[model samples]
Target: MSVWLENAIARANSTSDWLSPIRSVSLAALKDTPWPTRKTEAWRYTSLKSLERATLSPSPSVNQDTPEQIDGFESFNLVFRNGEFDLDSLTQPLPAGLMISYLPTASEEMKQASLDEFSQIKPGRHLFGLINDVLAQHVVRIEVAEGVSISQAIRITSLIGLNSESHTRVFVKLNKGASLTVSEHYQGNVESLNTGFVEYDICAEAKLEHYRFALQTDKAISLGGCHFKLGERADLNSTLVGFGSDLSRVDTDIIYDGEFATAKLNAFYLLDGKELFDLHATVEHAVPNCTTLENVRGIVADRAKAVFNGRIHIHRHAQKTLAELNNRNLLLSDKAEINTKPELEIYADDVRCAHGATVAEIDKHALYYLESRGISRSKAQVMLNFGFINELIDQMPNQVLAEWIRPQIRNRFAEMEVTR
Candidate 1:
């Protein structure tokens, strides 16, 4: 590690508590691991040198005047200033059958148990996750009781302040027959770094729809990961929308802990103005009679670049498992670039699994047809781009949320900025 990184680690350790086992694990992991490069299989297309050289600092306090409604859409909001939970702003009573508790405020028993839980996940294999675990000062834990179905979505917003590095861990649990939807929005204007880790533990017959929006300024960088474990007959639906970040990446892992579980991973990303994005998703079918569908679509304009890697693993015992993975991208400019890879590792003879990836420019023939109908070329391009991602946007559960994101997508394509 460089001197700067060593100093940053020291600063993180100083403010962090003497949490059991996590401190030792993190320090050792950081020492043994070097910054990722193109040689790393998982990061072959993305570089982390910008993030490694960052001067990390704890977030300073800022005003808490959060918006009650954004774009005329409202939901139950849990705002986090920097990486710490906003206790003062989140004083309202939680909805029925739902509970929100902060890890720093957790009881002794719960704190110790969190260590055990962290060990089980073993996030140390990934360098960023290890760093977050070792230095995380704030963690939010949400739980839904059995047989409870929440009507309103729970939204968590993490706002970065100034030149700061925010590390956070979030845990969510749903008991048998419970269902809920959770949305995570990361927005900021400062030149900062945000590292977060989230875990979802779903019991039998539970359902969860997890949505994420990363709409940071081009000066910010974001590194995050999510892990999901599903019990028998449980289901998980995840949708992600990303835009306007200097560098952003989300690594996700989904595992089936019991038979008959299902998972759907859908994402759409829009990048322009030299922005960058990377998404790595993995699904493991360890039990029989499970199903999975992974689909991602992206549009790259200007000089921006993006990467997508989707992998599905079917174990020997996971008979009758059905899984499909696909990645499609549209490049609007000659300078824009995308690297997409889809892989399937199946060990069961009785399973059907498939994966495919495609990258292409807008269809010329279709564009000509629209242009011939008196439509301007610029308007036609915007219409076609919207049609490309409309399927994924339609998958969103709420119309208000979809409408809120539509303008972001529309504005990106309508601008049609291309560099000579």
Candidate 2:
């Protein structure tokens, strides 16, 4: 084991009313999980050597600035800074039949309930997920009672204020027949690195729509994992959009536990100016008649690098399962890099599964045609790149968020300073 892993294990085993089990599990997994190195197939393009060299410590105290509100959405907002929840900044009330509270401040019943499910889903499979489980301090807990449907969106924002390391854990549960929408917005100044973990549970017939926007400054590093479970006939839709960060990785894991479940996962990433971004996703179908679809698109420019790994698994009993995975990337500069993999593992004979991956640069013929028609080369390139990701962005149900993200996509091309 590396010296850093030893220290992490030692620190995690220290005193705390909570996190003891997490520490034990994390420490046990340290010896088994593979280190993310150049030789690792899944991590071939993303090297963890830099993280291995840096000494990581708990973040320092931080006072957050006032949060900026978005129009047209009356949301219940929860704010966190440096891994600590700021109760005073919360503006909206918890919906009827729903409860939202910080884990450190939750009641004994809530704490016990959370602990019961903390390690229920395996986090050791992913190195970053294990690291987050062992190191996260504050946790946001949300519970939706049976038969409740919340119309308002619940927004959670994690902002880093200084040059330090921080971690966050979030747990969400939806009872049978419950429906809700949750949005996580991660933004920070160019000061520090941030890491986080979020887990979700959906009961029978429940529905959940989750959207995440990660926009950090150029000097920041962010790593996160989303683990989820779907019950019988449950429905889940998730969209992830990332634009700004020096280095970022987002991993998602979804499992179907009951029959007739459906899930959709869509993601878009834009990187420029030496930024490195990665997305790893897995969908497992354990029951019959379950369906899953995954689509991810990325644009890289000016030495930026992007990686996408997508996998779909169908168990022996998962008959009649249908799954599709697709990953596509567009490179605007010769120096830009992209690595994509789409994998499918199936044990059931009556299942339908397909995967496709593509990596290419801008089409010179299309650009030349547009430029000949009195359009600037830069604008034509931007238009083509935007069109590449627009296919997925159009799937977003919230118009407000879709419009909000369009400008960021345009701004990324503008920052590249590419001209005809």
Candidate 3:
């Protein structure tokens, strides 16, 4: 093992008291799994050779503070820094029938029960997830009791400072017939990086709406994975909006274990400069009459690179399954790059499944037409780019989040002129 890995394992063993048995098992998985390389089929587009080549030391704790102004809608908030939960900053008197607490603060029985379910998940298959499993110090837990529907959204903000590495684990559970909206916001200093894993379970007839907004610094790197399981008649809707970073990757995996479940996944990303962003997702339909739809779009500018890999699987017993996947990319510069693959694996002939992928440069004819109409080239380009991504962003159920993301898209396009 590399020195960094060895040191991380030693630290994990020393601090095992603070970790659950399942977390300990995750550490073992990390030790066995090798770092990803070009040889790996799934990682061919994302070369982790540079990350393996560098020696990364453990980050030192610095002045941890949150901005006074969040510049957005008000809601119940949970903030964390450097993998440590800040209880003082959290909102008081959580919604009725809802519980939010740090894992380490829970009783031994509750912690162990949660760990039992958590440990069963396999993290060794993904190198970044394994890293998070070993290094995370705190785990955030959110539980919604049966028949409770939270009127207000719950927001989780993860902030990182310069030269620091933060790892975190999150678990969200919705009891039978419960409903909730959860939003995760990730922001970091120019020189900081973070890696983490999130696990979620939806009980029978429960509903979960999840949104992730990743606005990271130009020099930071982030790696994260989310695993979800849906029960009978459960519903899930997920949307991800990301602006590129030096290096960033988000992986999502969802499994339908019971009949009549439904899921929708939508994502939009804007990449510029030398930034690299990737999104990988898999949806598995194991029972009959499940439905899934996935759509992802990217706007690449300058020399930045982006990738999308989506897969939908239908089991032999999953008759009457309906699934569709599509990915589209708009390249603005000659040097910009995008790689997309849509895959479908079906075992039931009665299922309906389709996938499509496309990558293309901006339409010069459209730009010329706009220029002939006396519009500036830059303004025309922004208009076309906005038109490319707005379709997916408009699907967000939260108008507040949609409005907050619009300016980000425009500002990113404005900054691209300098970098290009």
Tell me the TM-score of model 3.
Answer: 0.94
Model 3 lDDT on a 0 to 1 scale:
0.79
Cα lDDT of model 1 by residue, 1-420, tens digit: 656567757875676563636777777778888867788888898887667666556746663546336654545787777787787645877778998877677798887777666635424567778778777777777889999998777888887877777777788889999998988888875678888788889899999989888777577889888889999999999998887577788888888999999999899888887888999888888899999998899989888899998889899999999999989998888999898888899999998888888888888899889999999988888999999999999988777888888887888789765332
TM-score for each of the candidates: 0.94, 0.94, 0.94
Please list the Cα RMSD from the true structure of every candidate, rounded to 1 decimal place: 2.1, 2.1, 2.1
Q: Tens digit of lDDT per residue, candidate 2, span 243-341?
A: 746678888899998899999999988888888888989888889999998888888888888888898988899999999998888877888888888
Candidate 2 segments whose C-alpha is farther than 4 A from its true place: 1-4, 31-34, 53-57, 89-91, 189-191, 417-420
**Candidate 1 local accuracy as lDDT?**
0.81
Q: Model 3, residue 204: what's the lDDT?
A: 91
lDDT per residue as tens, model 3, 357-377 = 888877889988999999998
Leading candidate by lDDT: 1
Backbone clashes counted, model 2: 0
* Model 2 lDDT, residue 133, Cα: 78
Residue-pair clashes per prediction, in order, are 0, 0, 0
Question: Can you tell me which runs of candidate 3 are displaced by over 4 Å?
Answer: 18-20, 53-59, 67-72, 119-124, 417-420
Candidate 1, 168: how far from true, in Å?
1.8
In model 3, the Cα lDDT at residue 50 comes to 37
